[model samples]
Target chain A: MSNTISALPGATYEGAVRVQEMGLCGMISLRGDHGDEKLISAIKDIMGTVMPGQREIVHQDERAAAWMSPDELLLLLPYADVRDALTRLETALAGTHFLAVNVSDARAVFRLHGGSAREVIAKLCPVDMSPGAFGPGQIRRTRMAQIPAAFWMPDEDSVHVVCFRSVAQYAFDLLKQSAHPQAGVGLYA
Target chain B: MMILTCPCCGVTGEETEFHQGGEAHLTRFGPGSSETEFHDYLFSKENPKGVHLERWRHAYGCGKWFIAARNTVTLEVYGTYAAQTTEPPQDIKDTLSAKVPGWSWREFA
Candidate 1:
């Protein structure tokens, strides 16, 4: 045993539409005066890009998205490299008054991938997850699995990252339960 | 089913996640700062024609407390920011100025 947990331990049950997996990925909450040219510059220099691209998947230096405000952005790195990422960025932007909060434990991420995933999410969440309403490369904050979450539906069979980690198992149970009936029981009915 | 439009997440949610922190941009007392001043401080508002920057808690939700700017007249939201921690940016100021003119920056600012 020496395997630290898989950042994404994909959880599954038979005949499920969306893949229910908890990503133990390292998550960071970044806040600062984004208006400060030097601060933004420092971050981009250290991390290559200060802002999450229009899409949910980063493709270049990992993936990220804007959580809400213009001044703040949420940056996610490979679970294992977070400490290194934080320390490097911290020194790089030392005096710029940027704060990097390690929220890996406070929030959990669950990935729901697959075309049937949208239909599965739509059942519990009121937000639009369809290609027409919500498409790839877009991330949105909405209520999901009965918990507040940021939904990043980046593509078909796409990735939907659900945060608020404590609720992950609860959400998993709910999604599993709700989506379960759709897939239906073999002979239990 | 109370629906809260999250500035971060957009207009999609059940009221369960958000906590309403009463009204935003409180009214103040003069230098006199009397008992009635304290009372009025606790209760008063502009509750007016345009955008209002109120505090909302994504309580049961994100557990993060943030402020939301919504227009009372149009019910159109302007923006949101972390509570008590930071001031909004220039774009927000410029947008609000154009949207809600004659706003006393020296006062609520």
Candidate 2:
């Protein structure tokens, strides 16, 4: 049997920050009315936590969920638990105006951290990367350089970013180049 | 780079974070409408040189659609509002009118 490989072959660094792939996480896209009592309860039962606030993330045990939009969320779980989560979510939201799609293989996640992680992200993303503007628990969808991506901060010094699987390598290269400490001087600046 | 705020998520980001949806508050012309009305709806644009109202989607943010009142010439933004409404809010129109004389969008003079 062919074995699965991580989108990123190995860890790399540009400046003070280290960039690495967070491989094979189960990513499920969920959409429903936040105000629906049943839906909220169902999610809580499955996640052991309520839906996160807009642009926020709710962490419980090893599971985490990020508010992807007003009525959408990106649920992250252990790759082994993906099927169970999907079945539970489907059964929970059965007939409602909801959509639960498993997008496990559609994305590649990258983790970046260090003192200059914010600067590296700022160089690639137009969104405010300041601690005051965006910090821990906040998630946002935006573009990295030229490709569409989403990012969230699990803490002040670390950022987790996701992009489509097809352009994972391209995005990784762009991030690596942008994360270069020397690249931020006169020429690229 | 112009900064556009998404009403839904309360995220303010550069124009690159949002996608321009062109002119807003358009009146759609359907099968029963006159040919001119349909043509106007399909092709006619205000294309104002000054203050303009437009639709924008925070495609990279909350992914919510919003309306923005801005000046094309100076790139000054007046305000951003939720996209659920069919017309520009009165406050936005008043702000534009106060900022630039005789400013109007269709009939909201």
Candidate 3:
């Protein structure tokens, strides 16, 4: 069996926004035609959830799927179940113009909590984080400082960020700096 | 920074959320086309100083590509539309005409 390690090495911060690395989750990049009934049905059968619409996320317990684009969805689940899920999905989507890639190691994910989580993200990304604009349960593919990243909010006080594994440390540092009380960055409304 | 609204996601955000894809509505010249045609298709671009239509992607938002009409000098975004279109819609043309009389773009111009 192969071993896995956290990108941030057990790093955790307690500040205005609590930042912690969400280590070693199974991530799959799924691309298919959402308008195709066969593909949709197969994905539903394998994932137990239909593909999410633009900026939408469908979550069930430890499994979640977020729409990456019009024709792409990112599936997140327990690391142990990845092999089983891939097999089932491959069997269901046979002979179709679809792509399922195991990208768990390609990216690192982090969860930010506390009341100022949104503001801290706002400092790094240009997308509107206000409740009126980007509310709870919405996912967006954007940039963190200069790094490509994606993030979503499960509730009013929390956000989950995923960035390329190579820049995991830089992303974490940027988040940590933004969470500082004296950072004093202006948030766009 | 300028704000652009994505037609796909209905999310209006800063320029950072969108990537500029340069001139839109180009007639792609592939193999069998003349040298001039290929040259025009590959290099010659209309860098108009006035109203221009462009291709943009909401890379950070919906991740869908789109098109936008804007002014180069004024930085005024006339509007944004779907990327699948072959040319600017009538409404976009009307808006551009209203903003600048006798405004024409490429074949439409």
Task: State TM-scores per candidate.
Answer: 0.67, 0.93, 0.92
Kindly list the per-residue Cα lDDT of model 2 for residues A1-189, writing each as its tens digit. 667666775756656578887888788998899888877888798888787888888888878888888898899888778889989988888888998888988899999987777877888888777667888888888878888899888877788899999988998888788777676533212
How many clashes does each candidate structure show, in the order listed? Answer: 6, 1, 0
Better of 1 and 2 by DockQ: 2
After aligning candidate 3 to the native by TM-score, how far in Å is the CA of A67 from where it should be? 0.8
Which of the CAPRI classes, incorrect, acceptable, medium or high, describes model 3?
A: medium
Model 1: TM-score, first chain: 0.78
lDDT of 3 at A69: 76
RMSD of 3: 2.2
- Of candidate 2 chain A, the 10-residue stretch with the lowest lDDT total is A180-189
The best candidate in terms of lDDT: 3
The residue-by-residue lDDT of candidate 1 on A62-152, one tens digit each, is 6453544445667766777778878877887777777887777677676666546666666666666556777665666656655666766
Which 10 successive residues of model 3 chain A have the least lDDT summed?
A180-189
lDDT of 3 by residue, A63-175 (tens): 88888877888998898788888888888888888998989888899999988888999888886687788867678888789988999888888899999999999999998
lDDT against the true structure, each candidate: 0.62, 0.83, 0.85
Error of 1 at B65 (Å): 8.2
**lDDT score of residue A189 within candidate 1:** 16
- Per-residue lDDT of B3-102 in model 3, one digit per residue for the tens? 8888987777889878999999888999999999999999999899988889999876667889999999999999999988998999998888888999
